[model samples]
Target: MARWRAAAFAAFLFLLLAVHCRGGKTGICYGRNADDLPSPDKVARLVQQQSIKYVRIYDTNIDVIRAFANTSVELMVGVPNADLLAFSQYQSNVDTWLKNSVLPYYPATAITHITVGAEITESPVNVSALVVPAMRNVLAALKKAGLHKKITISSTHSLGILSRSFPPSAGAFNSSYAHFLKPMLEFLVENQAPFMVDLYPYYAYQNSPSNVSLNYALFSPQSQGVIDPNTGLVYTNMFDAQVDSIFFALMALNFKTLKIMITETGWPNKGAAKETGATPDNAQTYNTNLIRHVVNDSGTPAKPGEEIDVYIFSLFNENRKPGIESERNWGLFSPDQSAIYSLDWTGRGNVDIMTGGNITGSNGTWCVASTNVSETALQNALNWACGPGDVDCSAIQPSQPCYQPDTLISHASYAFNMYYQKKGATDVACSFGGAGVRTTKDPSYDACFYLDSEKIINTNSTPPPAPSASSPSLPGLCFTLLLPVLPIVIASGFL
Candidate 1:
């Protein structure tokens, strides 16, 4: 009996951990090419409040690195292009730099990746030759510090490196970069570091609107997907097509197993008249859908269910960046730290207008099952909500206060609202693949009260309401007792 209890307890713990597992993670880039941006400390706080887990910065400025210390946020620091030649010339240069900038606040700040340079291919100066040497020196320094395995070393590249990207299977790199890329690809494969590239579907669409549709670029549900004739695979979004193109490019070079990471990708919120696709709505739509696609493990047609880590191009709009109007407006937030528009980092597809750095919504909004959808769809959504969605459905079980209604809609409403509130009451949380709907009216009954965003602001503090007096409350007690056996039941398909 003792051994059985211990095994059951272990399974229960494993189940709890698995509930929160995600296929991919979304991170944001923190660029400070502006004079009016907030201090790093404030920026860190804002990032934490928004539940962001990873941040990439251009350089390892001490103040900025120190600001993220003792925080959950992970840092991906970089070596600027200007300093690449110096670092590449000598390992001692990288050693000294790491000793001062990294060794002090490494584990505390959670510094993960050290990107050597940004877009060396696009750099005005011909510093492409220095990239591999700089990377080697950085790797040697990390090995000396016993951090070679802990921290990854790579450089960011622009799409310009690829000579061909259309019909993804035919993707190939430019012949001119062969010498630089071969050695770099070898280093990446040996070190097991991902090939980091900065992809911008926004640019692809902007430069050639007739070739790339706005819906295809935005990951819109209504997109009439483009078909790659060579591979016979239909691509629903430009992002996936771009990713698969890079994958094929790596395969072309015999680096088939190399992982790809999106070091930067985002849409601009504003642009000149000619830049018609650059608007706030388009930006929000592209980012929101991108987050959903990534977090949900919707990989490209070429590589189904491949996990990719993507960092949104920018954190704030840099007033200092020189280019077209769209170049200066790629930030998710303004310089003042207010969100340009809300984003649901959880990938629940909820987006709303944010004001004064707080997510605002109707006070009484609640998610319930839609009457218009078919009952079968509702059931499927309900099953999803209770299963993978991680919603608690104990309140709707027999003998509970909410069990009196005993209807599919009532039970689903409880599960949907529970999920909606748990996901910060975002509109997309109520979507449930179009089987759920949001309403401003209260759906509470005699003792079965429904939760809204306002009521469950702090989910931890507010527990579910107790059962009514007439019921013995045996269901709740039984659930608590059976919690340890849940994993066993689920694994056996007996739940």
Candidate 2:
């Protein structure tokens, strides 16, 4: 028993050191686009605890930089799209940015890469034209400062940049961006920096659920594989296919030697209605398999035996990220810094994944505030459930079926469960700032249906359209609760 314990401890240390040495492919993207997340210091500690050595932030926030300082984690800092024009035009601005942002905490921070802009092709700002110029200027500035070789410089592109990618070999850049892409490719090759791209099989499968196999998108080996006729490469998963497509695209452009780094790739563990296969089951499968696949150092078919670096889409789900619900739900850890899923990262269970709140595909479900939860926390969550969280809370109004009992607890429970059910009955969704709890016991009262997973509103039963301002009281505000009294109380939480 003593020998086993000693061996386990040594193995754990080795896993951490291995991750630190290579900046493992199992990195996390730290997105701060939310309000309720823990501070960077806490999050950085969480990253180290997970033994995650690579981190990519969407922008160069010094707080985040300082959080990872002296922690031996490799970081890829970003330059927001808004700064692209300035970064492209002025060598002085790049110098100033590097001096202020990069030099101050660099070696201690393990700042490995500086991603100038993210998904430039997908940005509506036409900043795609400024990417290479910005990169060139930044590189020049880094070179002038003697940190050029130390910090690799590049920009992240989306898979949307590919015009043709299905066959993998036929992958080519969209003709429209030839002006921007060619020069950018040249810069990456000359500087020996890797080409970074955000790839999402979730988006691919979600967009074409009918034709694409859900199992294949989730990286399940049981999937009916697709064969690329040109290379005779049989792909059991969409991740390898998407990656090989870029390899083919780069080779077609004669930039065969450049490294490929996946800047962001993840399955959203939850998403809004109409998004098929976005669940904890699928997410855990994709991410777990991705980590194993990367750790095996088995490169994609096109780039055989080569290791590629990848950063997972996010560390925490950002509540304020705009777009579909999936945009806000691609987190590995809950906002409270709890693991939402488990992984045998070291093959020894050295990392204890949090399993307390992983409620999925259960026999039943109920969302209720814990007995001792704070009224203030419950009220804020109630506000979120109704307003931006988009719980259909109309039935909880004074005159409605669910409003028989006027107590805040009763009304909040109804709103919370509705939001919870709509969010795939996941315990994380029911987390109303830790005030909420998931229960198997039904809390349904008279004329009120406290839904469980079994009682899910049929997929065909669409939620009622949100009340419009022109006809109703307000545009974005929720019309649930005792309309007058509830909205006033909820507004104070925001204040």
Candidate 3:
């Protein structure tokens, strides 16, 4: 009896472990720029605790991989920009990179993908040219280690690759980059690897607040939205526009079969005065909304019902990150492994980092955590806001507004509706107000309604026939006078 019980216990444990490993392919960018973050092992615990099954590290950090050993988390490691030039010239360099940086952590850490270079287009060096050769060498090295099929090799890109990307359908790659891009696409298609891009709609809005709608960019519940002339497809959110822009660019390149994965996409919790859309409210709005869309396996307008995979930009903010303040502030968590923002992936609210109500300063003066609330409370909050069939926080608000809760819900709804409407469904205008309507009211309905009384009741492409004195009928007379006076009525607010 004792032996049978032990065997049964072991079998149950194996099943539980298998279920944990099958959590899907969602990954997080585990950037290490801060000095005070929890150690790699502790960080591993945090990741597992949060149910984050995959991670992408910027470099071949041995400690990180080793810590993840024997666990289910999959890792996609990077070969830094500085090392690419060397790997490009000599195949041996890539072989060594594999042996020293990769194979050592194999089987244990589950290193699934290796990025040859990071954001080569934006790199200062002639790194773009080196990417292809380095990728080829890395593949060869992987084969040498008998780990070829186990790991994927590719490079990540920024949205800057698109020379034209406004309407998305009209997207095109820069003429200057076609030489390299053409071959790169061929390689990716042959290898069965995805083309990764770091997309952020927040930057677009920041650069052009006058043209980009805050709701559209931040995934708000507002905006009349713009229609793509070529596709007659309306874009409710800027993120979808950015993604489809890449799709259009690829299609134009004659590589329509290639898969595009978003490797990084998130908003900053802090920013300079000039950076208009970087507020916590907007960040919470963008990320929370983004999470809802991602969990649903949402795709871009051009590829509806497709399961588009994306990795949120980062797990924690790094004070050490150089450049604009926003660079150091894009983390979903504070340095101490506490969530900087609350996400609805688990289907409830705790303390959302974007709101700063549940998040607090724990890692340092600048960091925050959701330590005050109990796990049950956090889970309940998530269920209330995130669970399927649950009342959408934005749609079913209190009859009387609770300033904090209402605003958070409004922002969350905007982000969720914008992303889903654009990516999941065929109706774009339905997600966004058709034109000039603006309101953040619900998940399924536009807050603002189109109210143009001057417009004809029905869409008529041709003008009506002229009425003669003898043939002046009551219906024609009334219609002619009504048409002329409609503009005045609308202007006078009497319609």
The candidate with the higher lDDT, 1 or 2, is: 1
Native-to-model Cα distance after best TM-score fit, residue 259 in candidate 3, in Å? 0.7
Task: Judging by lDDT against the true structure, name the best candidate.
Answer: 1
- When sorted by lDDT, best at the front, the candidate numbers are 1, 2, 3
Ranking of candidates on TM-score, top first = 1, 3, 2
Can you tell me which runs of candidate 1 are displaced by over 4 Å? 1-20, 350-495
Q: Write down the lDDT of every candidate, Cα atoms only.
A: 0.82, 0.75, 0.65
Candidate 3 lands at a TM-score of: 0.68
RMSD of every prediction: 8.5, 22.7, 20.1
- Candidate 2 residues 1-495, lDDT tens each? 655544554454354445433423668888888999999999988888888888999787889899999999999899999999999898999889888987888788999898988898888788988888899899888888888888998889999899999989899889898998888888888888999999999998999988788867765533556767785655667888899999989999898888899999999988888886777767877777677567544456565436788888888888999999889999988899888776545311111113323234434757886555556656766887787555788888979989878877888888888876755554334545445666778898778878766666464267667744322223221223233343443354411
Judge candidate 1 against the unseen true structure and give its global Cα lDDT, from 0 to 1: 0.82
What would the TM-score be for candidate 1 when compared with the true structure? Answer: 0.72
Clashes of each: 0, 0, 17
Of candidate 2, the 10-residue stretch with the lowest lDDT total is 347-356
lDDT (tens digit, per residue) of candidate 1 on 145-228: 999999999989998899999989988999998889999999999999999999999988998999888878887544566767
Candidate 2 positional error at 184, Å: 1.1
